[model samples]
Target chain A: MNLFIASLAFSVVTAATLSLAAVAFSLQFAVSNIFNLAFGAALTLSCYAAYFFFSIVGIEFWLAIGLAVLFSGLFAAGMSAFLVGPFIRRGASAFVLMIVTFSLGTIIDYGLDGGFRDNSFTLPFGGSSLAIHAGPFELSGAQLVVVALAVVMTAGLAALLHRTRLGIAIRAIVDNRMLAGASGVPTRKVTTVAWFVTGLVTGIAGLALAASTSTVNGAIGDNYLLLIIPAAMLGGLGSIWGAIAGSLVISLADNLWGVFVGTQYEVLIGLLVLMVVIMIRPGGLAGVISRGWGGT
Target chain B: MAYYISTLLVLFVSYAILGLGLNVQYGLGGVLNFGYYLFFAIGAYVGGITALGSDKGRVPALFQEIYAWNLPVHLPYPLTVLSAVVVAGVFSVGVGLIVLRSVRDDFGALMTFVVFLTMFTLIGAYANLFNGYIGISGVPSPVSNPELWYPILALGWLAISWLLVGAVTRSPYGRVLKSIRERPDAAAALGKNVRHYRLSVFILGNCMAALSGALLIGFIGAWSPLSWQEAETLVVFSIVIVGGRGNNLGVVLGAAVVGVGINEAVVFLPAVSSDPGLIPSVQWVLIGIITIGFLWVRPRGLLPERKAKWPWIDSKPGEVSEGNLLRKLRKGEARK
Candidate 1:
């Protein structure tokens, strides 16, 4: 019972961290129709930014987080505008976009390696995470913060999409770009903003994930990629709420598998669950857009 | 200097073989095979294990930490290489069974990446299965003399595989594979067995991949997980993409450029800044940029699959010309 509760506590923390990134990743696909394999690099890039500020410059943690988010968002927006935008303009398809993103990822990840020399760094909090004891389970201060942030972010995003004009425009762009463009939606500008916002969320997720893992490196994001994909796949490709639910299911499955089986098979178990889920649902948990093979 | 040049030539040839295999699978068949190194590893390990006389070479050193195996069986080199090719080919059949069901290109790539990583996890984590990361060593080479053997093997294997590739590409069988690659649904509508062709090409390409691995192991006299890095697949595939797809000579040319230019350029540089990563990181950054640049701007590659051919034949020039091209130049081939 105790072991089960501890695993549950841990999984909630994991789910909380993953939901932010998963939803952001789903959003990128939704608007741009890109797989954005480089999103992994964004995660690493933000994590390193946080590490640099928190560990090297020794700033307030929250301030460092803010800096990282702004930097990531700006970088992503700039990338979309300057680098990726031209190719798409030249009539690149999703498949070509996937490769393009892959290239960007390689450049960013390895470019950092050359600059930073491949050494692993940790987020330098002066002290450890505050311990909290409740019933049979124990948790950390950061863990609870993770849960709160996830709830707040999900709720905030839901409200934004539901209530705001910009959110409606973003959705319009996703559904039918031509129709949206015909209806006086600023499709290109809206897209840039959407990219910026998703980039910020991705950065936050990266920061949270780095904290959860307790180490940061260029390679760290690549491994996180395995986890992020299942989360995004579990949640439908484009739905925001679906991402949160998917994160919970995947994280819960991963922790339980660790408890019941061995940790070695944890990743495999998550993947298998995703495979089964995707096979049955096909549209994902709350699929807004149904995907067909070999289609635009 | 001779040794260095020979070693470089040998590696270039091996990578050329890899490029050729990828050219078939990706170029002609339209199957995205990102985890190609796994097949190479399968061939290397199978060949090494076959030629390796005793587990005695590994057990004492390996068991010092983890698991041990007791064995004694060494096959002849010819049989060993053949077994390697056959085993890897057969293994790919099993892989194709599952992967071909979904035609989503990115999904296929992702699944292969998963399989690639899983292979490492299994080999690295399980001490008993692959001796757990210490790797296998001291497999017997095919010939006693390195001088004659290497030069012959390098040129001989490249020529042989190039010829075989050429033959397959020019056949009517090859014609249908390209049709499937261009339009699977349309090709199927025309009564072509698209799935079967894809799988056959996949299996055939892997057979060549295995053969290369076998020869590579023979040259090095060792086999290990280290030899087949996942990135190696992408690098080799990038060569195919950079070389003109559907052209064997172009693939070999691309391999030589990347093999010597980007990969082996490290040999010349003075060690800078005591940081071992500086060179490799720069190299990867360059590779990533170059691949993307070519893919984005010049998708057809440096030497685009040539359309010009012998004036006598009036078929489309690029569809494997039959003006007595060696290997693929069989007389009486069906013309459109």
Candidate 2:
């Protein structure tokens, strides 16, 4: 009763943060069908960037988010162009590309580790303290902010995808790259922009994740990656809406398991959900996300 | 210096077992197993516990000793190693059933990778299972006089692993595995049970990997979660990819290159900084560079596996479709 409600309330806050990463992940896979394993590296890189801006540069918290997004987005775009895009353009298999992305991520991970020395640094952006009691549950100011951001961002993205010309161009590329190019879509430019925006969103998501979690480290991306991929897969990997919905479901299961089962087994919950979903629906929750639009 | 070189030799031999096993599966069978390290971890624990004898060992912990096992007569070293392999093999049967059904084509490797992550998380989090982060210590050693014994021990395991892999690869079974790797459809059309062949090969390879793990823990006289990481698998994968996949001689060459040349040789490098994290970070970065550089510049590895005599490699070479030529020309145009 009260416990159940409290669990649900807690899960909502987590779901909000999970959706931010999920949607960003969805967008990266959607265009050009790049199952970029470096999504983790991009996330970890942005988290470090946000930390540097706020703590080292003495920037304000809100402003740091914008800076993190800008820099990480640019880095991702360059990386995609130089590192990954060439492979995709060369027409590598989905599996090979996945390994390449992972290698890219590992490169970034070790570079960060060498730079940061494996210390899990804490961001002063958010502090653990008292929370406001809202009915049966308590929500921190940061938690409330995260929820609001998720809601607003979701609305904004929905509009961008469904209404804007850029979004349509991106989706058209996903639907058919050669056909879209033949049909005068400027497929290359649209794809580059899409990858950049994907990077931007991942950067923001990284910040949110760092603020919410206990510590930030070079390993943050790899650790966070384990959960994000499953969540993305749960909804079907490329569907933005499915990614959002799947995150909520995953968060719900995660919170419920934490409350009921031992906290140590939290990661197992996601694995269980992924396996079950995989069994029941191989095509993912939304539809077949197995390289949708990107031809085999 | 003699001791150091011997130690490196021991590690190289151990890693060779892991690489050789992987060669059989990925090289001959075409099964990509990213989570292969899990079997190695299982071997250490199972083999260590079996020989540990329960009378003298206690799991180390932060606050208190967790549990004590009933005193039983300890299994002999040879039997314990056999048991470790068996355990890892049995474990794979369960994994294969799920992974094969859910994952098709290249995705199976990623799915297995997920399993590795899950296994690591569980071992790390639950203190009761493997004593949490601190891990068990004083697991009992196999022989006395390390310098003399280790090389012998290492060589023994290496010989067994090598002979086993050589035997399997030269047999008709190996041919079937290679054929399966090339064309499951053609083999299935000829009445090969594709599912069964895949699982059996996977199980056998995992057993070899576990055997190597057992030997490693026995030599070190202890075991812990820190000793194994998913990244280690990446390094081995890089080895196979670098040394020539599926080629037994190639995997041995890869093991020597990676296990001794890179990983073990680093032990002697003078410390540039005492920052504690500097060395490990550099090592991993070097591995990443090696992996990526090889992937980009020379994907077939230094010693590419000799082309199989089967028609699989030659398929469609004589006939080039207009679409393929168009695609190639388009790629050229795009580059221009």
Candidate 3:
């Protein structure tokens, strides 16, 4: 029972970071309708950027993180404006666009691999040893911060989508791109902004992940896709609430599996869940909710 | 010097087979199989283990656990390659049945990617399976003088693959595959079984990949997780795109240019630093750039697919073609 509680606490932390990434990923797909395979690379780019600022340039830790997050947002916006926009304009099919994004990811991933020439780096967070206990759960200071960050980001995103004009524009675009354009929404500009916001989310998620794991590497984001893709997919591709709910389920399953079974097959178990989801419920949890109780 | 040239030729031939396999699937059939390397890895492991036989004593201590199954039987050279092809074909059939059922093409492709990652993690985690990360080594070569004869053997396999793919591309079945790629709904409306065609092409293409893997393992004398990275599939995709999708000749040229040329060209670069990974990293970045650049500049590739012409209609000059006549009649009827 103690082990279960400990795992539950860890699962919450994992779900927090995972929700941020999954929501960001889902949002990108929602606006552009392109499955941006390079999103993972964006996450890694932010982590590395933070490393560059703090370790190489000798900036303060929090300041470096802030700069990294901003840089990541701009980078994502630029990718949409420069790389993805042109290909979409040129009448590339969905599959071709996916290949294009995948290629872009490869370039960024290997570019970092070449530049760093090292496998892993530790961020100077200096909070791993500081443990805190609340009720039956114990989490480190960094994990608690991560959980708090996720909550704030999720609330901020919900408010933006529900209460703001830009959020409505994004939702309009997602509903029907042609209809939204006919209704006088600046489809392209709004999409770029959406990309930027999601990029910011992606950056925060990357940092949270790095803080929890204590190391960052080139394959860090790529490996995280094992969890992020499944979570986002389980939530339904483009739904924000679905992303959060999906992350919780996936994170809980991962931690519970690690506790009950061997830890070696945790990734395998996550992937199996993903396969089952794809096979039986490609529409995901959101689809089920939208369809009502008796609808298939 | 001869040995070096032979090695390069062998590499080129192996990649050409891989490119042809992908061309059949992605180029002709329009199936996006991002996990294509999984089949190649399967082929390599199966082929290597079969050749290694059941002699656990000779195997490394780290990998001796694999022989506990006592099912690794030593086969002749031809039988080993055949077994690799059959195993990959069967596995692809099973996977294709599930994956091809996806309603969306991108979803299917993503599933393939996930499957590849799953296998990679599973194989790496299970020590008894493919000896985990250490992989299998020290398989006997088929030919006595491998340096001289192996290149020829690999070339022979490539020729067989080329001929097989060529025949399929020119046949009526190939045209049906092309139609499914162009307009799947239209093909289905015409009573063609699109799913069946995709599954068959998927199986055929995977078999070719397996053959290429078996041939490669025979020459390299090792098979491991390190040998078949998930990214390796992109290299084949690059070959197909750069060569020319749906064009066999262009795919071969692509294998030569992208596969062999870019790979060997890196050797001429002056060592910038002692870091062993720098050059390969740069090489991959270059490949990514080239792939995107080609997709942008020449989407049809250097050798685009030629328009299929009917000899019966084109052979007679100054004659009204049946296709044009039918269109003219339809236009006339519409006016009435």
Candidate 4:
């Protein structure tokens, strides 16, 4: 029972970090309708960028993180504006777009692998010893920060989506690009802004994940996709709240499996959950919810 | 020099077979199997295990202790390869049935990729299955003079694969498969069983991949988790894309050019740095660029698929093939 409670607490932290990336992924898909298979690579790029800024350039940790997040946002925006946008404009099929993003991911992943020329790098978080015990949960300072950041970001995003014109434009584009364009929403510009926002979230999520893990590698983000994709898909590909809910469920399931079964098979269990969920309800949890509420 | 040539030949044949399988799945049936290498890995593992025999004493003591399960008997080379094909085929059927149920083609592709990653994690974690990261090695080669006979054996297998793929792609059934690839709804409306055709192609393609793996293990004498990373599947995709998506002969050309040619070319480059990983990383980056560049510049590939025409229909003016539109315009036929 004690172990289970600890696991539950750990899962909440994990879910908080996971939800950021899942929502970002969902938002990207929502706006572009492309799966953005390179998303994991983008996350990895942020980690590497932070590493570069902190270690190589002698920047402070917090400042380095800010710069990394900025760089990642721009990189993602550039990818949308230059690489994916042109292909999409040329009317590439979904399969072709998948290949394009996958190939782009390969370039980034291998580029990092070659440039780094090391198996793994350690980030100097220097806060592993700082732990906080809240009820049954024991979490590091970084983990607590991650959880708090998630809460603040989620609330901020809600406000932005509900209160701002840009957010409204993004929502319109997601709902219907053609219709949004017809309504003079400047669909392309709004979509790019949406990509940038998602990229910022992805950067923070990657940094949080790196801080928690302490060790970073080229494949770190790629491996995290094992969790991110399932969470995003389970939440319904385009629903923000669905993504958050899905992340919680997946994280709980993963932590529970690690506690009961072996930690080694946690990833496998997550994937199995995705497969079963996809098989049973192709539209995901959001689909069920929507249908229940008399939505098409 | 002779040995190097033989190795390259075997590799070329192996890649050719893999390319053909992917061409069948993605090109003919429009099933994007991102986990194509999983079937190949399965074949290699099964083939290696079956040939390794039940004698624990034959292998290193570490492997003996690490491997949870062992085949009870040592099968002959033919039977080992056959077992690989059969096992991979069965596994593909299971995966295909589940994955093909997704309404979206891209979703199915992503599921296949997820399946690959899941299996990769499973194999790496479960050391008992294939001895973990150390992988299975030390299977005796069937050929006494491998240098002389292995290439010949590989060529024989390639010949069989070629004939098989050729027969399937050239027949009337192949036309239906093509129709499904172009327009699944239209094919369904025409009374063709789209799902059945897809599943069949999926199984057939996966079996070929397995056969290639079996053939490869016989030459390399080892198989491991490190051998079939997710990116390796992209290499086969590159072969199919660079050669020609729907063209079998073009796939062979692609295997030679992209698989063997680029690989050998890298071997000759002067080492720029002491880092052992640099060349391979750069090579992969190059391949990714080439794939994207080709997709953008020449989507049809070096040798595009020939337009199939009905022999009974009389020739009609101004009915130019898609690929020959430029030529038709150059010839001033559009004015008529």
Candidate 5:
């Protein structure tokens, strides 16, 4: 029972961290119609930023996180405006855009590799564990915090998207760019905002992962790329709520698999799950339920 | 001077071979094979194990890491290379079976990347497999005497490989592959066996990749997991994209340019060596900028795939529709 509870705790924490990245990935795809392979690179870049600030400037944990988010947002916006925007303007199809983003990812990854000199740094945080019990579920304070943050972020994002003027405009742009443009939505500007916002979320996910693992490296982002794809796929591409649910299911499955089986085959298990999901439910879990995973 | 030239020649030839394989898949077949380095890695390991005779070591390797075997006295060096290609080709078939299901382009790329990392991790963690990171060393060189004859032999091998590639590209099968790239559903409607063609092309490309890997391992006289890193795959893709992906001659030329440029430039960039990070970072940045720039400026590449024409038979240049030329131009623009 304790082992089961512990696995659940682990799953929740993993799901929490993945939610931020997965949501951003889905959102970016929703608005821009580009599968940004460089998204992982952005996460890595920000993780490095946080590391640099904490180590070089001797900043506090919160300050480092803030700096990382800011830098990542700016970088994302800049990339969108300069690199991605021009290609979209050229009438590049989705397939070519995929390749373009891939090349961009290579550039960013290699750039960081050169800048950081293939070094690995640890996130400086050391604390004793605190445990808590909620009914039959025993959990750590860290796991609780993860759940809290996930809830808060998801709610915050939902409120922002549904309530805000920018959110409506973003939706409009996604639905029909021409109609949205005619109706006075600044599609380009909205895209830039979405990019920056997505970057901030990605940055948070990266930091969360760094904190969890206590290590940061350029390869760390690449490591998550595979995870992000499956999450988004399971959630249905461009579905925000679907991303959250997908992350939960995936994290739960992974944790349970770890408990039942060896960790060495964890990835293979995930891949197998994804394969089955793709074969049986191409629309994804929520996609099948709601049938909103079409058209795009 | 001769040694450096020979080294350069060997590197160029190997990369050229690798690039040609990519051109067939991505260029002709329109399959985005991002995890290309895995096959190359497999080839190197296979060739090394085959030549090394038996597993007397502590760790098991790929296939039969613990298998007891010996390279017979009668088996020639070329036969060993052929053996490597065949083994890697078999591995590729297995990989294709697993990943070749109906998948989106980017999804396929991601899956390929996953396979690459998983395989690497498996090899790295399992010390019994491919000796983990210590890597197999002291594999016998392809040429016993690295004198006048070695370069000639290597160049001759390269030429023969080129001829094979050229012959395949010119065949009706190659023409259909290109058509499949242009429009898969349309080709299927026209009675083309799209899946079979793609799988065959994929396996064929892997064979070429394996052959290149065998040659590289032989030249270096060593093989490691690091040698077939996923980055190597992207580097080859860049060469194919930049050199004109659909064009055979252009792919080789692109490899030559990138290989010769990066290899020779590293000699002058002392800071890259001193810092280690400086050179590689710059190389990646250059690759990115060049790729984007090529897509923006000339997607067709430096040497665009020229349309084969029979001037005397046609006798009409102006009357020929520009649709094919336009398609070529669009493809060239995609290089960016």
Candidate 6:
């Protein structure tokens, strides 16, 4: 029971980081209509940026987080304006655009490899851990923080999408960009905002991932890149709630399977689940549920 | 000078083989196989271990020489190449059966990536399997004489690969693959087995990739899991995309230029500073630039494959019939 509980707790922490990347991934797909393969590399670059800031400028971890987010957003904006935007202007297919992003990812990956000398960095997120006893479940302060942040971010995103003017524009653009443009919404500007926010989330997710693992390597992005696409697709790439739900499902599936099969095969099991889900319902579990609910 | 050219010559042929295989899959078949490195790894290891001999249940770790089997000398050299192709082909089919069912193109690509990561992680972690990071070394070379035998071996393999590519591209079956790419639904509606066709082409293409890996490993005389990274797949992918995806000639040219040109440049170029990572980093950047340039500019490549004319050439069939037996032989050789 104790081992099961420990594993469940770890799964939640993993889900937290995955949810951030998955949600951002879903949003970018929702608005831009590009799958954004480069998002993983962007997350990697952002984490490295935060690591650099912490090591070089001696900033607090929280401050480093903010800086990473800023840089990610700015960098994303630059990529959108220069790299992705130009290709879109030329009427390139979304698939072609995705490849372009991948090239950019390759560039970023090797650039980091060159800059950081292909070494893994250790991000020390304080030395102490507070343990909590709630009924039969025990929680570390870091794990608690991860879960809390996930909830807060999800809620904040929900509120932002539901309440904001930009969010309305984003929704309109996603549905029909030409129609949205005719309605006086700046689709391009909205896209840029979506890219920036997506980038920020990618940075935060990377930092969270780094903190959770306590080890940041050059292939950090490469390691987790597989998970993001699955989660995003499983959540129905354009749906935020779908992404959150997908993350939870993937996390739980991995954890439950890991209990019986072992941790090494957890990803293998996650992949199995992805295959099953995609086979049965390509739109994902949440996608099916939402569509049914909306239909009625 | 001969040795240097031979080295480049062998690498060019090997990568061209790889590029052609990928071009068939991604370009002709529209199957996004991002984990292509796995097939290459499979070929390399299968060929390496077959030649290196297997280790019987020996001591675990410290004295552990896992699963080494000493075979006859002749058996290790050429036959292992066939085994490599077969093993990699079988693996590709199994992978295709499982992951290729119903997924988005990008999702399929991601799954391939996951496969690559998991497989690589396992190989890296388990020393019992292929000796971890130490890799399989001294796998033995194909040629006896450096200058004479190497080029002979290279051109022999190149001729074989080109013949294979030519046959596939010229066949009515090739048209079916292309039709599947351009219109999956129509092909499916017309009674073509969509999944089966894809799996077939995927398996064949992977066999070619594996064959290329076998040749490459034998030339280098070493095999490592790191030798076939997921990033390396990107380079081959760029070759296909930039060289004109479905065009064989373009793919070969693209492979020669990107694979050989940039690689040799990096190999021979003096490091301005002592940062050892600069070479690979710069090479990656060059690959990125070339890929992006193709996406932006001449994506069709310099020598795109001409549309297949039914009369075998633009010249009428009667004119071809007028040619003598020698001319026919020459034409057949050119076709080969």
After superposition on all C-alphas, the RMSD of every candidate to the true structure, in Å, is 5.2, 5.7, 3.0, 3.7, 4.8, 6.5
Q: What tens digits encode model 4's per-residue C-alpha lDDT throughout B106-215?
A: 77888888888889888877888887777989976779999889999999999999999999998988989999999898999999999999999999999999999999
Highest DockQ model number: 4
TM-score of chain A of 5: 0.91
lDDT of 1 by residue, A102-207 (tens): 7788788878888775378877543245878898887777777777888898888888777899999998888888889999999888888888988888888888
Question: How far off is residue B13 in model 6, in Å?
Answer: 1.4
Q: How high is the DockQ of candidate 3?
A: 0.52
Better-scoring candidate (DockQ), 4 or 5: 4
Q: Taking the candidates in order, what DockQ does each have?
A: 0.50, 0.45, 0.52, 0.55, 0.47, 0.42
- The window of 10 residues in a row where model 3 chain A has the poorest summed lDDT is A287-296
**3 against 4, candidate with superior lDDT:** 4
lDDT score at residue B298, model 5, on the 0-100 scale: 82
Compute each candidate's TM-score over C-alphas. 0.89, 0.89, 0.95, 0.94, 0.89, 0.88
Q: For model 2, how big is the iRMS in angstroms?
A: 2.8
Error of 3 at B79 (Å): 1.1
lDDT by residue for model 5 (B1-336), tens: 887888788888888889889888888888777678888877887777676665444123442444234333323588778888898788878777656664455555556666776777667666666777767766666566764556677677779888988888888898899889888888989999887888888888888888888787777777777676556666787788789979989998988887566657755766744576677678767777677777778888888987765344443334544654554465795244
Higher-ranked by DockQ: 3 or 5 = 3
lDDT of 6 at A202: 83
Q: Ten-residue segment with the worst summed lDDT in candidate 5 chain B?
A: B66-75
- Greater TM-score among 3 and 5 belongs to 3
Question: Is 1 or 2 the stronger prediction by DockQ?
Answer: 1
RMSD of 5: 4.8
CA lDDT, candidate 3, residue B72: 54
Clashing residue pairs in candidate 6 (N, C-alpha, C atoms within 3 angstroms): B53-B69, B54-B67, B54-B68, B54-B69, B55-B67, B55-B68, B55-B69
Candidate 6 TM-score to native: 0.88
CA deviation > 4 Å runs, candidate 6:
A57-61, A127-131, A135-138, A288-296, B1-3, B55-64, B68-76, B310-336
